[model samples]
Target: MDEAIIVDAEFVAPVGTTAGEFVPIDRAPAAGLLLLVAFVVLYAKVISKLGKPAIQEFLWEIITRIVPSKQLRRRKEAQLRAIEVHTQRSNTSSQDQFAKWAKLDREYGKLKVEIEDINNSLTASKARFFTIISSAIFLSTTGMKMFLRIKHRKAAIFWLPKNAFPYPIEYILSFSSAPLGSVSVSAWLMICDAAMDLIVTIFVALVVGVIGMLRSNKVKPKTA
Candidate 1:
């Protein structure tokens, strides 16, 4: 019986080119990874600024506008108005007006039930709106990352110095079947993402500090 030998092939540049040589075509993968990192970071910052509630509310408003929930909203408002009117009428009525007071109380109870129904419907609609938006965002980000990873699986984003790190670290950095001492798509993406996040954090902190200083200066009493 003949043994089958498995040969692992490394990525090779064009003829006469070295493994880690800088080629003009290498810029595409590097730029793509950088753009992805920047986009992710910017998206995170925007989402943080808006907050989950604000995003959900924004989507809900758009959904309501498109679906014309105005009728339900108007009904809810009318119910509230009716309830208020009943309360006032009951308050001004005398004890001898027992029948009228009873009718007003019954009408108020019905109005409360109607308003509760409208509120429940709106809540469900808002939840669905947010769910759709969240799902779309998740799919888009994940899909882009996966597509890039597969497309550039064997492409070196950039080359590092020879023996830049120990063998173990180099192996890790060259993940997804990339050459040693070369930054692969996955590794470059991680680096870019971390660096971008750090920069964003520092920028936000500086902005907050500057705003704080301006507010303190404005509120500070002038020295006599």
Candidate 2:
């Protein structure tokens, strides 16, 4: 019987490994991780404002406290009746069901306003919640780029937060310098990587984009 020879060679897997593994942490990686932790803490704070689960829980807490069970039951029954009627009547024109739609839209609006009020209260308790968060996330993203671009130096100009720009701006800087730095096969390779990234990002963004736009309507006043 012929036995296959086992070869020891490093190869990038065609399909990447998805598993738990340890990479030795150095100062730079550790510092980057620490910064990531800080950003995440702040990001959670921001999402607490934007996130629906938090808001739903918040509303439910307040709702259970104030609204009587009888009232909540009646409201639920009413909503169910409207839904059942619409379901049973297959021939009902969607436009002709303006009243039902109006009711739904109104109820949805009330839910939205309640969520907004909680968010507003949260915003007030923590003023500049969105601005500060957006700024921090954007700055951290840009700072990562600047750290890569500017040589490791102790100079304040390089180290200062003032040097950081908006998130999109960093891409512009990196993209522009690309022409100057990418003069060989290396540049071409980088472009391929960038194109792959852009394609994935755009695809993801399109999915998010639809949801994001719907949120405006979801969060807005009910107008049939």
Candidate 3:
């Protein structure tokens, strides 16, 4: 039993190492994790902001699906009538109130076909933003874990860039840490890389999307 316990413990991921380090599947510092999560959330917010209208349109599309699929105006009217009947039935029992509320909700849902249709697209875009950001977070975490292993000289999954400047980022694998005066050359390199990533993603998306959009617009007629 004790041997089994020992083997089980070996596989368990520790929250922090003996000297106070958090590793997601490997011992990484909390600060790195914080930055990764922040980036994920912020990225999601950015995507959501950009796709808000599309998401709204999708949601509104769904309403038409549920309410007017066959254009069942009679079913909707029947629910409205049910609401009227239930409303007068009694407040004596909780079930009666719930039944009334359910009918009213269903009726309202039926009436909000256009709104739901618009909202369906919005909901989809909203969900997609979260999914992409979540993926980014997953990849960042995996990369960080590999980086930690490199820092500790434990293992290497891939070769670090020959030109890549190294920082004693491993030294900051503790809570009692702060940025020091006169940023390291390696830190500057990291900063430049991050800036380049942001600028490039934006520029490429804009240049590509705009080219397609402009060409399409030219060949298209203006809608009245």
Candidate 4:
């Protein structure tokens, strides 16, 4: 009877391995990983720092640009005038006229209230959306950092304070312990590199096109 040999069974069933195996770390890859960690921290910081202001400004700009303020004022003034007219009529008119004006006054009041409520609700929704998105980004980064710390035993380089910590102390301690150089250096380099590449590519493309256009014009014979 021939025995079947299992090849790389340990690899296939790594969980079954009793003792841990040592894997060599390469500096290049390690540096790259650190760089990635730095990028995540910096990107999150940049977004969180700028995102709120940018979104707020953009929302206000949209409201200002698309909503006709003049029209809104005109409508409000007209509604006010209608209420005033009905009030004056109700004061001196017959019972039937008074009843009709009273109904109109109530309806206009409700309508104005509803309009204000709707505007308030819309404003609240915009703020909620901004909060939710920003929170999601922040929580996601914090979760990732937490996971890395637990699984890889990596030190916390950059991370949000844990919810378990007390407020002001948490803020002070977490920030004080942050590895700012590790977090920011690689991130800035990556950002600068990307920006420079984009600029150079655009400049080169424009120059090439202009040169081609000039050459074509020079070579073309003038029409009589």
Best by TM-score: 1
User: What 10-residue stretch in candidate 3 is worst by lDDT?
Assistant: 173-182
The TM-score of candidate 1 is 0.65
Model 2, 69-145: lDDT tens digits are 54445555655654564454444455988676666666655655555565555446344444554565556544444
Candidate 4 Cα misplacement greater than 4 A, ranges: 1-25, 51-104, 154-224
**For candidate 4, what's the RMSD?**
15.9
Candidate 1 lDDT tens digits, 41-93: 46665455546677777777776678867757777686778868686766866
Model 2 global lDDT (CA atoms, 0 to 1): 0.44
- Specify the highest-lDDT model's number: 1
User: Candidate 1, after superposition: displacement of residue 164 in Å?
Assistant: 4.3
lDDT of 4 by residue, 34-116 (tens): 56555655555554444556756666568756876654565567567657756665674556677866776676676677567
The TM-score measured for candidate 2 stands at 0.24
| lDDT: worst 10-residue window of model 1 | 1-10
Note the Cα lDDT for every prediction shown.
0.69, 0.44, 0.46, 0.53
Cα-based RMSD of the predictions, in order?
8.0, 20.3, 17.1, 15.9
Q: Is candidate 3 or candidate 4 better by lDDT?
A: 4
Pairs that clash in candidate 4 = none
